[model samples]
Target: MSNDLAAQHRPALFHRAWTVAVIACLTIVAAAAFAAMPGVLVDPLHTEYGWSRASIGAAASVNMTVYGLIAPFAAALMDRFGLRRIAMTALVTIVVGAGLTTVMTDVWQLTLYWGLLIGAGTGSLSMTFAATVANRWFVRRRGLVIGALTGSSAFGQLVFLPALAWIVDHQGWRPALVTLALTAGTMIVLIALLLRDHPADLGQRPYGATAFVERPKADQGAARRTLRVLYGSVRDRRFWLLAGTFAVCGATTNGIMWTHFVPAAQDAGMAMTAAASLVSMIGVFALVGTVLSGWLTDRFDPRPLLVGYYAGRALLLAALPALLGPDSGAVIVSWVVLFGLLDVATVPPTILLCRRVFGADGAIVFGWVNAVHQVGAGAMAVFGGFTRDMTGGYGPVWLLAAALCAVAAVAVYGLTPTAARTGDPAKA
Candidate 1:
C-alpha cells in the first residue's frame, strides 16, 4: 500500500484534491459503523450477559470522554506525524479494538477495547480531520468539501445500521462487532493506498491556489500546543459561551440520544430492528440538516442560528418521552425526523463562530471546546444509565436534557451576533 500521490502539474478536468476528499468521506462513513454500534449494543449486551445498562453505559462514557479528550491532541499528532500516518494508525487501532470485542468475557474488556481503544481511534478522526482535509486540499469550495465530509457519517449510518440491526437481532451481538471491525479494516486499505499527508507531498498546491506554497512545518510538541491553546482560550467570555453551549449539545445528542434512544424505544416494547431503523432516519435527515445549516451559516449571524437550533432541540427533547412505542407511529416518525434535523446542524454555525472568534487558532480552540462537549456527553451517558437503573425509566433524563438545551439556547442568545462575523478576531 503506497501513500504516494504522484507529482502532477495542472489537473486536466478534475483535481486530485477531490480524490482525497472522497477518501476522507469513505473513512468517516466507515467510522460511523462503529459509532452506530454503542447504542445498538446496550440492550443486546444486557440480554446476553445480564450486564446492567449502567455498567455498559459506564464503558460508553469512557469511550466518549476519551474520544473527545483525544481530539485536539490527535490534530496536533496529525501535524507532527502527517495526516496519512495518523489516519492509518487510527484505522488500525479501530480495527483491533472493534475486532477484539468479540472475545471479551467481562466488562473491563469492553472498557479497554470498545471504550478506550475505539474512542481513541475514532477521536483522532473527528470533524477536525474533515476540516484539515478540506483546508489543506482545496482553497476553493472548502466549506462544500467539509460539509460533504461531515454528511458522510449520515450516509454511513443509513447504509450500515439496517444491516447491523438485522445482524444483532438475528445473528447475535458478536457478529455485529465483527462487522464494524471489517468496515474499518476496509478503510485501512483505502487510506494506506491513496491518502497523502498534504498537497505538497505530491508536489502540488491546494486546489485553486495560484501559486505553489511549501508544506508547513510539523508541530513538535502536540500536547503542549493543545494545552497552551486551551489556557489562552479560557479567558475569553465568548469561548466559555461556545464551550458551554457545545457541551450541552453533546449531552443532549450523543450522550443520551445516541447512547440510549434505541434501548429506550426497545424498553417501550418497540422491536430492536424498528428502533434502529428509526435512528438511521436520523442520519438521513441529519445529512439534509447539516448541509442546509452550512449554507445558512454563510449568510446568517451564527448566534441566531445557534439559538434556533438549541431551542428546537430543547422542545423536541421535552416531548421525547411520550413519543416512543411498539408501533412506528406517525408521532414517533415526526419526532425522529425533526430531532434528526437538529442533530448535527449545530456544527456548521458553531464552527463558523469558532473560526470567526478565534482566528488562526480557531480549529485548535474548537478542538478544546469539542473536548468539553465530549465530557458533557460522557457524563450524560453514564447519568442516563444510572437514571434508568434507579428509576426504571429514562423519562427524567429527557426532561433534564431538555432543560440543558434551553440553557444552551439562552447562553447562545447572549453572544454578540455581528461581532464574531465582522470584527477583528481576538488574538486567542
Candidate 2:
C-alpha cells in the first residue's frame, strides 16, 4: 500500500490491537534484560574490581537519575515523533550499551556503559510507554492492557534473572552482557517487524474510541488551550500526591529491591544462586500482581488499591529483617512472592490516574511524575548501599523503606478524583 493511501484508509479491526500487544512485549523484554543485568552483575563486579558496595550503588544511582531525567523528554519525544520510532531508537541504544559492557575494564567504564547509556535506553523504554499505549488504545480494557504491559517487565526479570545469574557465575559478567545484548537485539527485530506508532497509523480507530474523527485544526489559540491542560496538571495537588506516592514506589522497588536485594541476601549468608532464585520468584508474582492491578484499575478507585499495595508492602518490609535467614527457603520464597506482586503493580493505576487528571497530555505529565519516581529510586539505591557499608547490615534500610511506604499510602489516599477541580479529565 502507498504510504499516503495507508494513512487515509481504515485500519483492519483487531490488527493494531495485536500489534500493540507484540510491541509491549518486545519493549518490556528489552527493558527487563537491562534491569535483570544489574542484580546479576553486582556481586561479580564487586569481586572482580574490588569495588565498594557504596560505589557500585552510586553507579546505579546515576543510572536511575538518568533514567528519571529521560522520562519527561521521552514523553515529549514520543508526543512529537511517535512511539515506534522512539522505542526502536531506545532498543538500539540498549543493545549498544549491553554489547560494550562486555569489554569494560574500570569502574568508570561500568558507570559509562551501564550507568549512562543503559540507563538512558531503559528510561526511554519505561512506564511512559505503558501510559502512551493505554491512553491511545482501548477505552474499555485500558487498565487491563496497561497491567499486562507493566507485568511484562516483571515477567522479563523473572525469566531472565536466574539465567543471567548462572551465566555470570559460570562465565563471568561479560558473557552475561553478551547474552542480554543478543536478547535485546532479537527484540528490536521483532519490534521493527510488528510495531506501529498508533492505531490510526495502521488505519484503524483506537480499540474503544467511538468515532474516529479528524482532530480540529489547531490555530495558535487552540494550541494554547491544549498546552494549558498539560500545564494545569502540574499545578494540581492530586498530581503531586500521586507523584509523591510513586516516588516511594520507586524507592521501594527499584532502589532497595532491584539494586540491593541480591547483595542483602548474600549478607544474610544466602548463596548467590539462592538469592537470584528468590529474586526470580519475586518476578513471577510481580507479573501476576501487575496484571491484576490493571484489571482492578478498570473497576475501582485506584486510591484504595494504592493504599492496599503500599500498606501491605510496608508490613512486609518491616517483617523482612526478622524473617530473613540463610536456610529459610520457605520464608524467603514467601517474601519474594508477596513483595514481587506489589512491586510494579502501582504503575498501571498511576498511569490511569494521570490520564484521568491530564487528558491528551497524560504522557508528558506522567513523564514528570515518573521522574519523581526515578529520583526516589536513585536516592534509595545510593543510600541503601551507603547504609549497608556503614552499618554492615540491611535492617535499617528496610525499616526506612517501610516508613516510606506508609507515608506513600497516606499520600495516595489523599488523591481524590475531584481533587483537580476540572472534574473527570477523561472528558477533556
Every candidate's lDDT: 0.82, 0.79
Q: Which ten residues in a row have the lowest lDDT in candidate 1?
A: 1-10
C-alpha TM-score for every candidate: 0.92, 0.91
Off by over 4 Å in 2: 1-15, 213-232, 419-428
- Candidate 1 lDDT tens digits, 1-428: 13232334333358789889889988988876677787888887888889999999999999888888888888778778888888889989999898788889999999999999999998888777776787678765665566677767655655467788899889998888887788788889899999887999988888976678788788888889888888888988888999999999989987998889888997899987888888889888887788788777666677888899999999999988887788659999999889888888888777667777766566777788888898999999999999999999999999999999999999997666433322444311
- Give the per-residue lDDT digits (tens) of candidate 2, residues 1-428: 68876555544456577677767766776676677766767778778889988888888888888887787677666666677788889888888888877788888887898889989998888888777766666665788888888788777866677887888888888888888788777777777787776666656677756567342232344334435555777677877898899899989988888878888888888877788888888878888999999999888888789999999999999999887779886777888888988988898888878877766667677877888898998899889989988999889999999999999888886776743244545532
The candidate that achieves the highest lDDT relative to the unseen native structure: 1
How far residue 9's Cα lies from its native spot in candidate 1, in Å, is: 16
Best by TM-score: 1
